[model samples]
Target: MTALMTAELAWYATGRFYRANDGSLADYGYFLHLPFADAPLFDGKPSETSAHFTFAATPFKADGIDNGALSLGLDPVGQFSLYLQRRPGATFADPASFAQGECIATFRRTSLVVGTTVAASLTSASGAILGTNVFSARLIASNPFEFAGKLYDLAQTVGMGITQFGTAATTPVAPPPPGYDLVLPFTGSAIALGRAG
Candidate 1:
């Protein structure tokens, strides 16, 4: 009878922010994640598929305020994925396919703004001639904020494209059936803003 076993893996990241201009004000803060997983074969083996996380300070920029006071914010975004492919044998210098890895998840953020202004003036000459003038102005701003994060696990599976096995045996193959369970987690954050001066 074939034997079966299970494994687990995990990862995490963190960061801090200080005011680049003024020590009293916090300019930005952030955190990011690298890929990780849990499985028997995954021990020390290089990961085929991996993920990254990112985070940053909010309210990147602001303008058009009577007072110079500025407000800040934060946001996060990232991606995650898993790997499926066979591990190269000890003697196999270049195995057809190492670990087939891919990203299956993603995230993002968005924001926008618009504005307008108008003015008019008139003047009279000594004779009877009159002169008039009118002026108008419009301003628009569109700023987008984005953040993302991701987590992933590694596994053994078949190759793709030219590396695909013959039709009869083309089906993807997962070594150790149950495979390894890895948890590589990551996080990211950021903020952006636009305004008319």
Candidate 2:
């Protein structure tokens, strides 16, 4: 998908659960919003505002983990990086889940590298550093397709890592968070769209 290098790709990821480093579990839910960019009227045709795709979270899924956005970048020479953000929402259905907070994940391909992908930090809305995570991602597919003049890929991915209750940045509190030291195994699929026409 070299075409993705010059364009911004919009993607969505979802998994069944968030397993902590210590072997606990929390519910996982996801949402997908389509129409990455504005499609304007052309050739005297009407704008298609009603054509869209959305996936609402199921009742069994935790609330705060509802919406997620993903950005994947792959360079010409075969390097890749990804950024994922999940917005916080209502109370958690699974008490094992982390406290309501805005979570961000940043990871890079490590196949040719020496170490694990960079660690990601989770922070509360209050700006307090919650915890940190270290994980590695594997791209399951690279086949690309075109839709409405845009390039698209239905990519599958898998990850394994640990989420510890404290950050390596500074002194962690006396007692770690609820899901501290939990093992995390992830399986996700994303609908990626390239912006370049």
Candidate 3:
């Protein structure tokens, strides 16, 4: 039997902001330093076959910051959605780099604003077995709140990305719009489960 490998989820998020004053776009972005996972995603034999993964998270305090301060200046899930992406040949080794492969799952909401406790979980199957030895995932949040120089009704939807486990380097889906200061990153680690082999 192949040796079992432990995996932790890592990522970085970028938020597109807007101003309620002149309908201008602003807010750069921030990184979230996540805590270690409570347990390994999988503890079974390694294989390049189909599998299901569930990713979940909550918005809360972190780094002396109370809750996620991305848009509304507070920690709120802001969006109630989850997503996954796994192409054939994906693996658990060095799973931070989400380049390209079979898309097992993906969920990005245009309008999702909810607390951590009510947040939804994402899942998907690679189908017939596919993926590398490492586990990798990508969470996309596309919600910008702030209209006419005022904080829009649910204008705090963005997370950080993780490239290396210990490295400080991370990436975002898009850069912060001009004149916008990306809000703070959210605390609380997301959940990743190896649903099946």
Task: Quantify all predictions' global Cα lDDT against the true fold.
Answer: 0.19, 0.27, 0.24
Q: Please give the clash total of every predicted structure, in order.
A: 32, 7, 53
Q: For this target, which candidate reaches the highest lDDT against the unseen true structure?
A: 2
Candidate 2 per-residue C-alpha lDDT over 64-105 given as tens digits, one digit per residue, 9 for 90 to 100: 221233111111112222211222232223322322232222
Candidate 3 residue 56 C-alpha distance from true site, Å = 16
Candidate 3: tens digits of C-alpha lDDT, residues 10-90: 333322222212332222221232221232222244232222122222222211112332111222222223222233232
Which candidate number maximizes TM-score? 2
Give the TM-score of each candidate: 0.18, 0.24, 0.20
10 residues in a row with least lDDT, candidate 3: 117-126
Measured with C-alpha atoms, the lDDT of residue 166 in candidate 2 is 13
Report the Cα RMSD per candidate: 26.2, 14.8, 19.0
In candidate 3, position 40 carries an lDDT of: 23
lDDT of 3: 0.24
From the highest TM-score down, the ranking of the candidates is 2, 3, 1
Q: lDDT of candidate 1?
A: 0.19
RMSD (Cα, Å) of model 1: 26.2
